[model samples]
Target: MTTSPLAASTVTADMVWIPGGTYLMGADDQYPEEAPAHPVTVPGFWIDRHPVTNRDFDDFVRATGYRTLAERTPERGAPGAAAALHVPGSAVFVAPDPSAGAHLDDLSRWWRYVPGADWRHPGGPGSSAAAIPDHPVVHLAWADVAAFAMLTGKHVPTEAEWEFAARGGLDGATYAWGEEFTADGVHLANTWQGEFPVENTAADGFVGTSPVGVFPPNGHGLYDMIGNVWEWTADWYAGHEPPRGCCAVRDPRGGHQAGSRDAAHPEDPVPRKVLKGGSHLCAPNYCRRYRPAARMPHAVDTSTSNLGFRCVVRPGHPAEGDRAATG
Candidate 1:
């Protein structure tokens, strides 16, 4: 076992040292994709205490003058491109009225590609990330995360690493904190209280992303590990095919890039990546994915309102010194 810096107080204020350990990577009870609950081990690494916020991302943008994927207009003749994909925009969740007879099957009823919907203007035209600077930054594609990670000398956590940290030393528990979604009648994370895509009660005091650290931290002092927003993982989207006769598959990445392509549309070979920690849009009636083991496959080119990311810095990484000196 690697010695944990967490005990030595070497952890930075903005990050937490997740001790290396073995844990069950997925859950068998919930969601078909996250099945065959298997054992995996990950090395200890430093993870952001919370999801990267708008203020944090804004600083990155200001420093590097980087433009997120959403800000760039799509090429005209791209394969499997939407008819209206010429504009620079990102997907935004606009809840329709319950009386409108919006079927849950058709996600288009709620999700619409809004022009000018980037990290700066999360809700399309009039809205601004400035209004919720403390909230986790949204409307980021995989490339955006890549750019941010590169600039900061950090890495996007792999699926195994992410799941391990999210578990917060809780080996096989269902949720991040515990088995109960709401422990002791207290809302632990920012999740949809009522029906999703139609009505949100804001019971957790938020309809969208809540300010990071507003909710209680998990066992590892990591906040928003379960909800607030879905976080990007480095691993590709694939089934949980753990190595047979496991010796605790160390740091198992998901499916390979070629196999991660969306099977639904074979014509478009755009690969999907794993997204963990279901977002604020998750609800009981819709997506009950606010659990630590829950996983979602997202296209690399797509950016949504409820998707964001955090980064990690493993020990012995070349950028480790740089991160410490800068942070």
Candidate 2:
């Protein structure tokens, strides 16, 4: 087995060295998508200590002149080509009016396709990243994240790698930290504390994204692995289909792109990738996905207020040196 880095200087301060190991990858008691929990092994690698912040992404943009997919206008025949929503935009979370009696089943009650909402303007036109520079940068499509990875000479972590690191060596635990969602009323991560899409108690001192490292880190010293914002993974969003009788899967990636197309909107045909962790919008009454084993599928072209990403660098890979030189 590869040795873990002993000194922080060996890797960038923004990243932490994750010692490779085998761990239980999914949960059988939670969402159906995470059924049949199985064993998965991943190699040692360096991962961002927290989600990528607006300031971090801004630096990358300034250095590479890269534009996020959300900043570009959709083609005439694109899936979301409705004249009203066809303009360059992203999906932002807008809490529904509680008096309206919005139902949790209908996502449209809280999500809006807001024009001019991108990484720079998280909440539409007037919003800016000036004050919350350390907040995780949201509204990023898969292609946008790929662009960031290319510039930094890093790569998105595979589904197995992401789960392994998020678990923080606590195999089969209900959360990244522990079994309890909150320990003795103390919130461990940023998640909805009140009714979903209606009320937010802000008990955790955040209604939306919180500054990175605001919460306690996991056992592996990784922060924001369970909540803050959903993180992108390299694996395509296909149902987990483990080998029927296999003992364990080694470095399992994911499904094919063709298989990851949105079944609900088959006509649109845009492929989706796996998104790990939950977001501040996750709540007990609503999306109960604030766990390391939880996973979601998002269209490659879709971006949202609660979605962002971090990158990984495998040991012995040149990406770390390349990133250092670029800086």
Candidate 3:
């Protein structure tokens, strides 16, 4: 199914197509490394109904002026220790228990590590972008989303093409539009509804990041994917222990070096190569992972204001192909 010459062209905006097949990938009773539900497939591609904005990476830095490693500053073979990267930087999730006070462990207490906070100042100093220019541009890192999917030719969807476009085709049923994270409590996504390391009953309006397209958009339409932030697949995390128990399996490259996980899947801190999606402190009492086989393992240079990315379209569109998927 890899026939995309750009696939008859015309698809790019908001991104869609998905079309792949096979489902029921994991979740053997909810996170035993996402348990033996196997049977994946994948093939047809194209995804990004939302989740990569700041006006589309600010029009890819206004067309190829491209620079985001938090905005660079090291120069010539850089990798750390220029006074800890002089300036230009990222990673910001601070809230280890504000007035909400007590959000469980709060991912090592609200994931701080701020340098300059990329994605255009996401809470690093004053946090600007004309005041959140519609938000959803986060710090980014897997080498700055593989350098924005190789300068926007596109190439960041593979964890079986991001759970076959986040199970928009539906199969094993469980959230993403099935299961039931909320019947009366209300919250289809945008997690951590209550006391994690504190309290964040944002209820869905959102306590942080949340504007890319609002909600109610699966079945391939896309939107939030599962919650709010946590998408960066390209696979590089592995943690198998299947047969239906003992969590951490398939496309879970969260243990090679990135976001490190696999201490049976949750002590968070050992994953690498990036792969976050719908789980910004996800909570059903404590981390639901949002859905579509929820994953986490970011750190390919480490960047996150909750991380963000989206771009796909490869079936056939090469009259002069350049902006393969954008409005």
Better of 1 and 3 by TM-score: 1
| Predicted structure 1: lDDT | 0.83
Q: What is the TM-score of each predicted model, taking all chains together? A: 0.91, 0.91, 0.34
Q: What digit string (tens of lDDT, one per residue) describes model 1 on residues 54-95?
A: 998888777667888788877775532345658888889998
lDDT of each: 0.83, 0.83, 0.64
Pairing residues by index, what is the TM-score of model 1? 0.91
Clashes of 1: 0
Candidate 1 lDDT for residue 321: 23
TM-score of 3: 0.34
lDDT of 3 by residue, 65-174 (tens): 66777777545334431354466766676665466566464465777656666776787877776576766788766666655665555666666567667768777777
**Candidate 2, which segments miss by more than 4 Å at Cα?**
1-11, 244-246, 263-267, 318-327
Error of 2 at 316 (Å): 3.6
The weakest ten consecutive residues by lDDT in model 1 span 1-10
Candidate 3: regions farther than 4 A off: 1-43, 46-69, 73-86, 98-113, 116-138, 141-147, 150-152, 155-164, 171-194, 197-229, 232-277, 285-305, 310-313, 319-327
